[model samples]
Target chain A: MTSDRFDLGGGEPIITLRDIAKSYWRETLEIPVLQGIDLEIPAGAYIALMGPSGSGKTTLLNLIAGIDRPTGGSLEVCGHELNGLDDDQLASWRNLHVGFIFQNYNLVPVLNAFENVELPLLITGASRGERRDRVEQALALVNLEDKMKNYPRQLSGGQEQRVAIARAIVTDPDLLVADEPTGALDAKNAEEVLGLMERLNAEFGKTIVMVTHDPKAAHHAKHQIHLEKGVLDKAVEVNR
Target chain B: MRWLALIWKSLMRSKRRTLLIVGSLVLSVFTVAVLQSLLTTLNAVTNNPNSSNRLVVRHKSGLTQMLPRSYEAYLRQQPEIETVCALQWFGGYYQDPRNFFANFASDETTLFQIFREEFGASGISEAQIKEYLRDGAGCIVGESLARKNGWKVGDVVPLTGTIFPINPRLTIRLIFKSPKPSDENALHFHYKVLEEGVPYMKGLSGSFWVRAHRPEDIPRLIERVDRHYANSAYETLTETENAFNLAFVKMLGNIGAIIQGITAAVVVAILIVTGNTMATAIRERTTEIAVFRAMGFSAGRVLVLLLSEGVLLVGVGGFLGVLLVNLAAGGVRSSLGMAMPFFADFAILPDTILACLAGALAIGLLATFVPAYAATRRPITEGLKAVG
Candidate 1:
C-alpha cells in the first residue's frame, strides 16, 4: 500500500489542454468529436469524466493519454506537449508516463497475469529481474499474486479487470487513464476494481483519470467532470 | 529480444491456424528442395571437375549414330592426345529391368590409360588393369554397381542386351573407385566382346574418348580432331567431356525449364497460403494490436513482432522439411535411377538447401507485410471500440 516511487511533486499540472479540438472525416463530411476542450488537472489528483455516448469523454481521455492528437489546440501531459510529438515520440511518452485501462480488460490473451503486467516495463528496457520484482509488487497490490500464472481466458471478469489495473500501474506512470475500467464487470467486481483504483490514488498518491457512465464509479474519484455534446459541464468535487 | 516471447505467444494463440500454415510451408519447401537438388545433381554430371583434360569424338549428327572405330587410331597418332580408346554404349539389364545401370563396351587395353586420372591416380592397382586386358571377356565394374548387386571381382555378370543384339557374359576383372558418384555407377567391358558378338559393330563405336597430354591443349586438339574428319562419310563432332555429358542431359528434354516452373509455382502457392493465414490472424486480433500500440509499442515494433512470427513459423517448418529430404536421399536416388540415370546420389546440395530456406523466409516476410502494416496503422480510438 506504500509507494516508495519518485514523487511527481505537488500542485504541478500533470495534464494541460488549451482549446483542444479533435475532428474526423466520414468520407466527405467533417465530423467533430471534441471541441474547445480547455482544462488542467493537477499532479496526484483523481478525476472521473462522465458523459453520454458521443459526448467525446473517451476522446478527451485518449488525447490526454497521448493515444490521439488534438487537431486544433495545445495538449501538454506530464510536461510534454503531446500535439508536438510524432507518433513514435508520443508512443514513448505514453510508455514512460501514461498508463491505460480499458473496459474490455485488454489483457493479451496469450500472456498470463504476470506477463501482461510486465508489458509496459518491457518498453522501458528494464532488466528481467527488475521486471520480475516490479511485476510481483504490482500483482500483490491488486491482490492477484496467487493468480499471476493464469491467462486472461482462465480468469474471471473481476480478476481480469484487477490484472488490467495492475498492468496500467506497474510502470509507475505519471498518469493513469482508464476508460470504463469496470464497465464489463458484475456489481461485486465493479466495486472491487473501483476500490483498488481509489486506494491507488489515495494511499500511493497516484494521479488517475477515468471515464465512466456509472455515477457510483464517478463518486470514487475526488473530482467529476461531465461533457455534453463535445462541451464541458461544471466540475464537481466529491467528499468521500 | 523481449518481443520474441510475445511474438511466439501471439502465434500460438490459435494453435490450429499456426500449425496449418506451418504445415503448408514445410510441404512446399520440401518439394522445392527435392526438385532443385535433382537439377543440381544432374548438372554435377556434366561438371566433372576432375575430367577437364578429356575429350570425346562422336558422330556429328547425334549420339544415336556410330563413329568409325578407325577414328581412335587417327586420334592416337596426335602428339597432344596422350591415349585414345573406343567406347560404345552397351544398353543392357541385369536380372530385372529394375536393376538397370550404365554398361559401356570399351577398348580393354587402352581404357585404363585414357581414364588413368580417374582410376590410376586413385588406387586401382597395375595388376587389376593387366588382368582386365589379359581376358577378352573380362570387364571392369564401378565399386558401387558391384556393391549394389552381388557382382564382386571374378564373378561372371550375364547382361541381356537391349540396344545391340548380343548377350555378353563377362567376368568382373576389377572394381574401381572414382571421385565422382555418377562415374561409380557404370561397368566397362572389353570392346572385342561387343565387336565379335555383333555383326554391325565390327568396326564402329559410339564415341572415341581421348585423354590429352595436358588440359590446356584440349581446345586446339578438339579443333584438330574435328578438322581431320570434316568431310568424311561420318563426320566427327569432338567436344570436352563436360559438353559430351551435357549433350546427353539436353536430350532428356527441358529439365531446367521444368524445374524453374515448378519452383516458381511452389513459391506462389506458399505466398498465397501464408498471406491468407497472416491476414486472418491479424484480423482476429485488432483490439489487441491497438492495446499494444496504446501501451507504447510503436507501429514499427508491432510490425516487427508480427513479421517475426510469420518468418519464424516458415523458417522452422522449411528447415525441418529440408532435413527430411536429406534423410530420404538414399531412397530418392534409388527411385530416380530408373528414370534419370544421372541422378547420382540424389541428395540435396548445400547451396540449394540454403536457397530453399531463404525462399521460405522471404515468403514469410512478404506474406505478413500488408497485414501487419494495416493492423499497426488502424486508428487507435476506432480500434479500441473493437469488441475483442
Candidate 2:
C-alpha cells in the first residue's frame, strides 16, 4: 500500500487511490472538493463512507466508481488503471466491474421492474433467453420476482430500492457503490434494505462501498471510513 | 435492436406531448402532400402521352380572339398533317350554370379522326362513330358526363350557351370513354349546328385541332403553321397540344414556385416544432439519461436511442398523412373535377409519398440530433444532479 493509504487488513486490494485530488470550477473560481487522499479497499469488503454535507464523500465515491476523474493522481480499480482510461474506456470498464445505487433510487420511470433490472445485460450483448433467466434470478434475489411488471411509481420506496439493488447486481459487478442507500426509507424499510446489503456482502461475497450520514446505517458496514473537509480523517473497524 | 423498446417506452413516457408532436407533423405533412399532388396533377396535363402528336392552332392574341375557319384548309395542306378539325369552345352549361362542363363544337367529319386516341377502337364503336357523323344535331358525350346527367343514346339534351347566343337541342348519338378522366368529362357536337344557329359565327372558329401523321413532324409543322400566318390580322400561335395545355396551367401564375415555397415553409416549421419538442423532452429526462450513462451506456449509444425515438414518431405521422391523403384522393378528384377538368385525374404519385416520408425522417434525425447530442455531452454529474 502507499505511505498515506489505509491497509484494511482484508483480502487483496481491489481499489487503490494515491494522492487523489479533485476540484470544481465555477467559471473563474476553482473550488477543491477532495485533496491528498490515499486509500486501498480490499476485495469483498463492505466499507462505509461517513461525512457531513459538502465533505467530498460523494466526489471520492464518484472517482472510485469511474464516473468521475481526478485532476491529479493515479487511481486503479479491479486491476484496471482508471487514470489511463478515456471516458468511453472508463464507461466500458464500469459496465464490467462496477454497479451504482443512487440515493433517490433513480429508476427509469418508463421501464418496469423486469426491464430496469435487465438494462445492464442489454449492453453486454446477452441473448434474450439469457437476459430473461438472469433478470429473473436478480429480481428473485431482491425478493421482487412477484413485482416484475410493476413500474417505479407503482412500487413502495423500499421495493424500489430493492429493484435498484437488483439492477446494480444483475451483471455480477465486482464493486457496488451506493450513495445514501437508506436516505429516503423509513426505519423498517431502511433496516430491511441494510439487511439485504449485508446479505449481499456476507453471502455473495460482493465488495460494497457506501456513503451515508446516519451512524446506524454506517454500523451495518464491516468498516467505517470518515472524511472531514475533503481529507481522510480516520478509519475504524465495526465491532459487529 | 433491443434498445428499440426502451426508446419506444421513453416516447410514451409523456403520452400527451408525443401525441401533440405527432398531430403537428400530420398537419404539416398533409398540407405538403396536397400541395405537392396538385403540382404533380398540373404537370400531368402538360405531359399527356396521347397528345404527343397533336397540336392546337389558337389566335396569337389569346383564346378569346377567334381564328378564321379557313385556317383548317391551310393546316390540312401540310404533308405532316394527317387530319385537321375546326373546334370552338361552346362554353355552355346543361340545364343550369352550376351544372357546367366542357362542351366543344368541332368539324364533324374530322373530329373523331383527329382525336383517334380518345375515340379509338377501345372507346366508341365504329357503328356509333358512323351514326354520329350521319346526324347534324347529334352530340357525343363522355361516359362520365353521361353517367352524371343520366343521359343515354337517343336522349335530347338542351344546353344554354354562355359565350354564344345559340341554345341547341341535340340528340346523344354515342357515349365514349377516354383513358383520362379529364378527357371523359367533355361533350362534342358538330360545328355546323353553331354556324346554322348563329349567322355571325358562320366562318369563325375558336381553334383548329391538328393531328400530325408522325410525332417527329409536329415540331416542323408548328414552326411552319405559325410562320405562315405571322403578323396577319388573324395571326396564329401554333403549338403542340402539350404546350397548349400548359398555356392554361400558366394562367395560375407561378404555381410550382408557390407550391414549393409553401412546402419549404411548412417543412421549416415542422423542423422547429419537432426540434423544440425533442429538446424539451430531453431536458425532462436529463436525470434518466445520466442514469443510463452511469449504467455504462456510451454517449453515442444514448444518442442513437433518442434519435430512434424521434424518427419513429415522425415516421408514423408521415405514414398516416400519406395514407389519409391517398384515401381522400378520389373525393378530391370528383369535387375538383367538376370545376376544373385537369384535376379529374389528380392523384398522389408514389414518388411524392416516398419523398415525403424520407423528408420527415430527415427532419426527425436533424431535430433530435442537436438536443440529444447536447444531452449526452453534458457532464454525468451535472445530469445526475438534475431532478427531471
Candidate 3:
C-alpha cells in the first residue's frame, strides 16, 4: 500500500534520527552503545561515519539501515518510522530502501556472482526475465559482467568486493550503507573500490553512508561525520 | 521454486555431514522395513486364503499331547464332516539340523481331499497326485524341498525322525509345487508307516484335520467335535484353520512385541543422529540465516528452507532403503522361507513403503524443528555477529 502517508516526497532527508540511543544488557548491568545521537542524511548525499572501533559507528549505521532498533528516541529512514514497524516490516523496508555492503564482502559462498546479485530481486515479484536483465545490468555497471558465473572463492578480494557492490546496488535502492567496505582489501584494491563508490555517488546520484576509520576511505564521500564514544564529534562537508 | 535450488546448494555445502546423516537414516529405515515386513508376512498366515473349510483338532491341553486315533472314525460319522485325515507331526531332518522343513505323516487316502485347496491347484499336476495315492510307501514332497535336496520323483528319501520312533525310507512318488512358498517346502507321507513303526503310536496320533462340507459348517462342526470328546481319554480342542495357524505363531513368544520394540529403538536412534547433525548444520549457518532475515525473509521462510533440507536428506534415504527391501525380497523369501515354517512370502507391501516414507518425513521434521526454530528465534544482530 504505497500511499501519501509514507511520502516525504523528493529532496527530503532519507534518514533522520533524534535523541537515538541503543544499549546492551549484561545481566543487570547496562552497556550503552549509542546515546543522544542526532543526524540527518539527505537524498543523493554520500556520507561516511568515522570513529574509533567502539564508538558504535557500525551500530549507528545498522540503525540507519533498519537492521537494528534504537532503544530510545526516534528513527526515520526513507520516510518510514522504523520504530513504528515490527521486525518483519523493518526487514521489508530495508529490502526496498537500503542496500548493505559489509567489510568482509559477505557474498554467499555457494551462489555465483549473478545469483548473488539476483538475491534481492528474488524477494520482489519481478519476473525471471526482469531479474536476469537487472542482474546483468548491475554487473555491467560494476564492470564485472564477465565474472558473473564465478563463485566467490574463484575471484580476488577486489573482484569479490565489486560483485558485492553489484549486489548492493542491484535493487536500485535509495540508500547504500557500507560498513568498512574496503577494510579487508589491500591498498590497490581499496583504491579501486573507493573510486567505484565515488563514481556511483557522482554519476548515479545514489546516496551512501559508510562506516570506516581510514581517512582515505572516508574521503570518498561528499560529507564526513566523526563519532567518538557513542557521541557525534563533528560533521564536515568535503569539496570534490 | 528458486528457493529449492538454494536449499539444495545449502545442503550440499557440507557433503560429508549430509552423507553421514543420510547414511544413518538409510540404515535404520532399511532395518525397520525388513523387520516389520517379516512380522506382517508372519501375521498374514492366520487368515491364509488357501485353507478351505478346514479345522484342526488337537489335545485340549496342547499340541504335544497325543489324541485318540478313533476320533477320526467318530468324526466321519458327523453329517457336516466331509473327510478326515490323521496328521501326526514327524519332527524330522533330512541331512542337517539346519535343513529344516515341515514333514508330517498324514492319511494318504484322504490327504488330497482334505488339503485339495493347497495341492490340487495348477502348481501340481493331477498325475502327481495320483502317483502319491497309488503307492503305499510313496511320499509327496514340495518342489522347493526337491530342489534343495536335488531329489526327483523316483528318488528314495529317508528322513531321520526326532520325535517319532523310527526312520522311514520311502519313494518320492510325487513332486508337487504350490503357489505359496512355505507350502512348497513340505513332505507328507502315509500315517500307517509312522504308526506301524512305533508300537505306542498305533492307537494314538498327534491330531486330526477335518474338512467340512461348506466353509459355514466349520464353526458348528468344531463345537460338536470338541463337546463330544470333552471328557473322554483323548479330550480334543478344535478350532478354525486360521486360529490353528495363529497358535503356532503365538508359540514363537511375542514376535510382534519384539518387532515393535526394535522398530521404536531404530527410529529413536535415527532421530538422535539426524537431530544432532541438523543442530550442528543450523549452528554453522547462523550468520547466513541472519542475513536472510535482514534481506526480508521471514523466520517461517527460513524454517521451511532448513526443514526442507532435512526432508530431502532423509526422504531420499528412506526411499532408497525401501527400494533395497524390494530388491532383496526374492532372496529373503527363499532363505527365510527355508528357515521359518509360516513365512510364505517376504515382500515389501505398498503400505510399508508409504509408512517408511511418512516415518522418514516425520523424523526429518521433528529432528530439525528445535534447531531450525532456535536459529531463527535468535536476535538477528547477535546472529550476524557469529563468525562460523
Candidate 4:
C-alpha cells in the first residue's frame, strides 16, 4: 500500500489530500468526525460521495469546500495548500475556485433571481458588462430567463434551488460541491435538479463533487465513493 | 449597485417599522427646526448692530429709583449726545391683565427728537407734536396699543398706574403711527403729564434715553456723562439698547444653554432609536448578508449599502422638517408679536441636515459591523444550510 501522502503531479491534481483527519470538540472530550482520509480529485472529474448519517460525509464536504480546516493532515485544492492558509485566504480561495450548494437552497430573499445569480461575480473584480453577460447566461442555463426579476418569495422551491445553482456556477469555479442538492424537493423536482447538474457536468466538462444518501443521485455521476464511520469503504464506477 | 439593491430589499422587508421610524424622525426634526428658528431670530434682533444705536440710562441703584430732572438737562449739554429724553416706566395694565404692552412716559419736547426715525411728519405732524408738548396731560400711544385697545386718534382711554400710587386717572391723547413693523407695540406719553399729576414728581425723573452720533462713541460718551455725576447723590447706569435687551433676557438664566441641552438629548435619543432599528434589521438579514458574501461581496460594500439607506431616510426626514418650518415662519412671527422674533434663520437647517445624515450613517455603520463581520466569517456550507 502506498503512503497516505501521495502526490499526483506538481500542478495537475485540482484537489489532493494526505491523511486528513477532523474532529469536533465537545467540552473536554474530542469527538472525531473524520479520520485518516487520503483523496485526489483530478480536474474536470465528476465525483459522487455516498454514506449514511454518521459517516462524516458532511464533514468531508465541508473540508473540501474550504469551510473547515482539517486537523491532522494536508489538503491541497486547485494547487493551493489549504492547511497553511488563514481564514481570509481560504475565503478568497473559495470565492475564486469553489462553489457550494446545500439542500435548503440558501438564497437572499431581498434580491431577485438575476441579482442573486450575479452576487458571486461582484467579488471577482469583473466589469459590470461582463457580470451582466455572465448573469444572463447563468439564468438562461437554468431556463430561468423569464423569471429573472422575480424575488425568492415569488418562486417555487425547485426554482429557488435552480437559482442557487446558477449563483454557484456563474463564477465558473474549478470545483462545485453540493451537499444533498435534492434533499428538500419532491421526486419530480429532485429529478429535474439532478438532470440539470448532470447536464452541467457532461456538457460543460465541469468537475462536480456531490454528497448524497440517494443511490439514484450517485448513479448519475461517473465515480461514486462510499464512506462509513469516518473511513472510505468502497469505490464504484457507474455508466451513465 | 449590489449594496443598494440589498439595502432596498432590507427596507422593504418591514414596511411598518420603516414607516414608523421615518415618521418619528420627521416629527421630531420638524419641532426642533421651528424652535431653533425662533431662537435664532430673537438672538439676531437683540444682537444686530442697527439695534445697538439706542441706549438707556437709569439710576445706579435700580430702574425703579428716580433720577433728578436736572440730570436730563446736564446730559443734553454734551456734544457727543445728540438728543436726550426722560423715559418713565408707567407700570399699567389694559382692561385684561393678559393684554400686556410697554407703556413709557417720556419728555415730550425731546422724545420726538430722539426717536425721529420712529415717528415723522408723515405719521404724526410737527404741529401735533407742538400741541402735545403744550398740553401737559397729553399722551401719544403706539399704533399696536391703539389697535389692541381699539382707541382712535381722538379717543380718550383711562389707565391705572401700579407704581406711582395715584388715582386711576389717565387718558390717550394721540396715536403715533408705527414707523417700523417691529415697533407697533409701544406706548409713549409726555413725562410732563405725569409730573403735573403726581405730587412727589417736583424733582424726580425716571431714566434718560440718549441718541449718539456714532454707535462706537457711546461708551466714551457714557463715561463722560457718568463721570460728571459720579460723586452726586444719584448715580446712573448707561447701557446700549442691545445690552439692555440682553440683560433682561439673561435674567431668565441660560436659556440658550438649556435649549442646547434639550437639543443634544433629542439627538442622542434619535441616534439610539435609529441604531437599535438598524441593528434589528441587520440581525434579521444575517443569512441574506452571508449569501451576498458568498456571492462575492466584500464586507465594506455591505456596510456602504446599509449606511446609504440610513442617510437617505434621515435626509428625507430632515428636508420635510425644514419645509414645515419655512411654511410656518410667517405665522410664527405674527403670533409671537414682540415677545419673540418671528422667522428664525434658515441657514442653520443645512447644518442640521448634515448632522442628521452623519448621525444616521454612524448608527448604520455601527449596526452593520457585527452582521457584516458575521456574514464575512460564515462558512459557506453552514450558510447554505440555513433554511431561511
Interface RMSD in Å per candidate, to 1 decimal?
1.5, 1.5, 1.7, 2.7
Q: List the pairs of residues colliding in candidate 2.
A: none
Tens-place lDDT per residue, model 1, B1-388, is: 2678888888899999888888888789889999898888888878877678899999999888998787777887899888888998899888887788989999887887778767854597787778888898988888878888978989999999999888889899999888765567889998989989998989999899889889999999989878988898899899999999898888878989999999999899889999999999998889988998999999998888899998989988898888888887878887776556677657788898899999999999999999999999998877888864
What is the lDDT for A204 in model 1? Answer: 87
Predicted candidate 3 versus true structure: per-residue lDDT over B1-388, tens digit per residue = 2877888888888889888887888888889999989888987898787666889989999878999788888999999989999898898888787788999999998988888877765466667778888887889898878887999988998888899868899899988777776888899998888888999888788889988998888888888888998888878999988899888888888989999999999999899998999999999888888877777777777888899998888988898888888888877887777777666467789999899989999999999999999999988778878853
Model 2 ranges with Cα > 4 A deviation: A1-5, B121-123
lDDT by residue for model 3 over A25-66, one digit each (tens)?
899999999999877778888888888889999899889988
Please give the DockQ score of every candidate, comma-separated. Answer: 0.65, 0.65, 0.48, 0.33
Ranked candidates, highest TM-score first: 2, 1, 3, 4
Q: Is candidate 1 or candidate 4 better by DockQ?
A: 1
lDDT of 4 by residue, B1-388 (tens): 4655655666777888888887777776766665565456557656755545678787888877888888877777777778888888787666665555666778777888777776763377777777677666667777756776788765665666777765334456667764444555666677766776787876687788888877888889778877877878998888887777777667757868877777777777776777778677766766666656554455556656666676666666666666766676656655665343222122344665565455545654554455555654666545555655
RMSD of 4: 5.8
Candidate 4 clashing pairs, residues 3+ apart or interchain: A119-B295, A120-B295
Residue B236, model 1: Cα distance from true site in angstroms: 3.0
- Candidate 4 chain B has its poorest 10 consecutive residues by lDDT at B338-347
Q: Candidate 3 iRMS, in Å?
A: 1.7
Q: What is the C-alpha lDDT of each candidate?
A: 0.87, 0.91, 0.86, 0.73
For every candidate, give the share of true A-B contacts it also has: 0.87, 0.63, 0.44, 0.38
lDDT of 2 at A97: 92
